[model samples]
Target: MHKYVRMAGFFGLSEPPPIPQSLRNPRGFRPFHFAPDDRIICFYLDFWHVANGDHILHPHALMFTHSSTLSNYAKYLSVVPDGQSRRIPWEAWGPSNARWMEGNFDSSYYSYVHGSRFAYKLPSSYDDTGETQIIRMFDFNPYAVRHSAKVVPAENGEEGTDADGLRAYEEDMTSGITHRDVTSPSVVSAGSFFVDDVHSSLPYREVARAVQYAEDFSILIDEANIILLTEDHTMRVHTM
Candidate 1:
């Protein structure tokens, strides 16, 4: 991770993912499309494990890092293999690179740090002069975890766009593990993903509208309505 940060300070990431026109539902289509906010970064984590009669057993997990680049208005996705310390960006790790290519950790063998979880950094800024910024620290134990960081909208909006604000939106979307079959508790962190209208104090109708097609727990906000989708597959629409 340190090496990648240093490299980012040097060469920096290449082209990022094109900004989408709208927040199309990851599973559906929409007529009115809005381009994605470049300031936001989204991170995703997935884990699955088999259980013995009364004891939990074997676990497998994988994490993906994707964020909107404020500079180029694009998205960069970094795929992380589970239970392993595979350094991202091919150039950082090669034949002689022991730190980056130390191989992934084993699931069965319990450890203090790398158990069966993973996480990645969200973009803070895109200055041409690469100054290092720590996005967030993730402490994941096999059973519990904690995240520490400040989540807020960037103030320098008129300059161009609030890259930090966009990153806030992305972080909100991909904070936890949303299961396909189970409905987990819905949480609305300011910048974390899946914030509903109840906390937002919007009318019920608008909350419904926002969630209708907000894809992957995202909202489309301008001067009108705020659309929100929860991790449990619930949608909420809110009026601005």
Candidate 2:
């Protein structure tokens, strides 16, 4: 079956005493694997407009792992920029879209696209890696509608850098599949698959308006089963 099961509702979050203003509108869900049997999902909340003349992309993140239930997740705040005269380029001075790299079991790498000028590969967590590794970058061409890029980290010291650095390449998407067509891809595993939302009739569509946005959903790949977080905010488990 294309869809195993569908859940409906919002993934609620408990307010942490005095909630920081940044996590007010938590959106953008990016799911990645932490281990073969574990999953970690990251949600990015925009805090761009709150910065008053401070050139920073003040976004906050909410992380959910196997150790924590959906209702009980950890919140992280971005560090403020050092008060220095060095200016951040205007192209990189706003909120960015983050996506987890598939097959990165160490959870050390992810990509973020800033504006439409550049896309960068950055370490997932500075504390875990102790260094911000800029694996590669693509200078975006505004005139081009879409491009194909791949960043593959060296395996077993193959590319001359340490065993952990990445090598990347980019090319235009000339086959007619535009970037917007694949902005939000499906999350699939060996046993089951998860989709943002299933097709519904007009009567049900009116009720599912709130959960219709793709960014509000995530999928958890459990052993022999799949947990889908539907646009309507409900979670459902389908057995293989």
Top lDDT prediction, candidate number: 2
By summed lDDT, the worst window of 10 consecutive residues in model 1 runs over: 201-210
Sequence-dependent TM-score of model 1: 0.19
Q: Compared with the true structure, what per-residue lDDT tens digits does model 2 show for residues 1-240?
A: 124332221132211122345764456532531221122233333222223555343223222222232223223222444564444431242112222122222221133222221122233323333342222322222122232222343444333233334432122133211122123422323322222322211100000001112222233433233344545777754331
lDDT string for model 1 (160-239, tens) is 22333432222223222111111122212332211221121110010111112322333223324333444686756444
lDDT score, residue 163, model 2?
A: 39
Output the number of the TM-score-best candidate: 1
RMSD of 1: 20.4
lDDT of each: 0.25, 0.27
